[model samples]
Target: MAFVAELSRSVQGRVVLITGAASGIGRATAHVFAREGARVAVTDRAQEDADRVAGEIRAEGGEAVGWALDVADGQAIETVAAAVAERFGGLDILVNNAGTTRVLKIDDGRYDAAWDFLLPILLGSHQRMIRAALPHLRRSEAPRIVNIASTEALGASSPGSIYSAAKAGVTGLTRSLAVELGREGITVNCICPGPIHTGMTAAIPDDNKTIYARRRTALGRYGDPAEVAHAILNFCLPASSYVTGVTLRVDGGLMVRNA
Candidate 1:
């Protein structure tokens, strides 16, 4: 219990909603928040996985609930957000961590694959979630929205052009929304992680992974999901209210590499 208690600076009693809470960074973030005494609403497309994560949190004497919904669907996002607000009484934090990636070349006729996969979860669903939670967030004294973007946003060309574009859009949304919501006492920010070891990267070929390790990262390894979660918590803290409209990179110093 003491171990979990040390994971937070001031997350106690806050109500947090995190999308893509089944696995990877989202799952890790949920655990981190719950450890800090936050009431967490864990949403994922997979009901079983969501339930498992919620159960784990409950077993640890933390407050948590699981909701299953496809973030790609606007209606589903609205329903989930409303339910969270109604159940929790109010919302203090929103983490838009749901996203999909498709590796298709620009010259390929299937360039739309990335857009079709990413638009709903990455851009559309996040927008809907924020809209639905805005009313409740406005009621809170300190409200925060953290959008998970990627380092690919800084470069025009990438392994997946469409994925890069989608991430770029996420960064843009973060800045624009920060301006729009700042007056409402909500601080909006983006986290652009370079190469985190998540389910999304499990399929990366070993040779390609080695090349990435050598050429891109200064730390000589992929980042852990918890590292990124820590950065998110930093942005969500009350002390960070003035630190808005920025993208904090938690990428093991990968952005500094030219190659």
Candidate 2:
């Protein structure tokens, strides 16, 4: 087989389930995988948005279906995971990309509420989805688990302590799960995106975004959701069979600077 053809065929006919796929990086990931010929399960807390994304993929000539899933709920994760496996015939890749940003001070009234609200979705949900999808993943010839963490996991931002902690936990979970599932051929990995132009960062002014990118990242610009989506795609490719437990930073060189 030709090298390029083999690479292109790697992810073809695979089944991929992505959480929080209604918008941002998750949405981009859904489209990318579907374009690569994967049957996609587009899931989110908002049913309409999820369905809209699925519809868009179908209009683009890809196989996809939408499901309303609240990742924070363990039972919901199990139910959705099973339904996706059944709908798509079987599961192959699971992307835990559902999350939000919350900044809270230790003395704030909502500090405890922030922890309660964020941890379950950002950290716990990854574990829940992995467990729920493990059975189906084990049946596949090339199974993969990609957990979407954030650069916050590697560095600290004031008042984002809780969010950072939760994301950090995600990377830890990825490493541990990778070791446990290595012998089974299920590769687990983590992606930490930085300065992405997503809904979470939409509130930041353009000027500030520019200045931050210039001063921080080596690329000197904010990354698009599709950029991170493609990084996620790399791990899902069958060619990545030997790669596991990797915490990749799709940060446009944000982590490499000291100046």
Judging by TM-score against the true structure, name the best candidate: 2
What is the clash count for each candidate, in the order shown? Answer: 0, 0
- Candidate 1 residue-wise lDDT, 180-223, digit = tens: 98888799999998888899898988778878887778987888
Candidate topping lDDT: 2
- Which lDDT tens digits does candidate 2 get at residues 136-244? 9999999999999999999988989999999999999999999999999999999999999999999999999999999999999999999999999999988888899
Task: Give the per-residue Cα lDDT of candidate 2 at 53.
Answer: 100
Candidate 2 local accuracy as lDDT? 0.95
Alpha-carbon lDDT, every model: 0.88, 0.95
TM-score for each of the candidates? 0.93, 0.96
Residue 136 lDDT in candidate 1: 85
What lDDT does candidate 2 reach at residue 12? 84
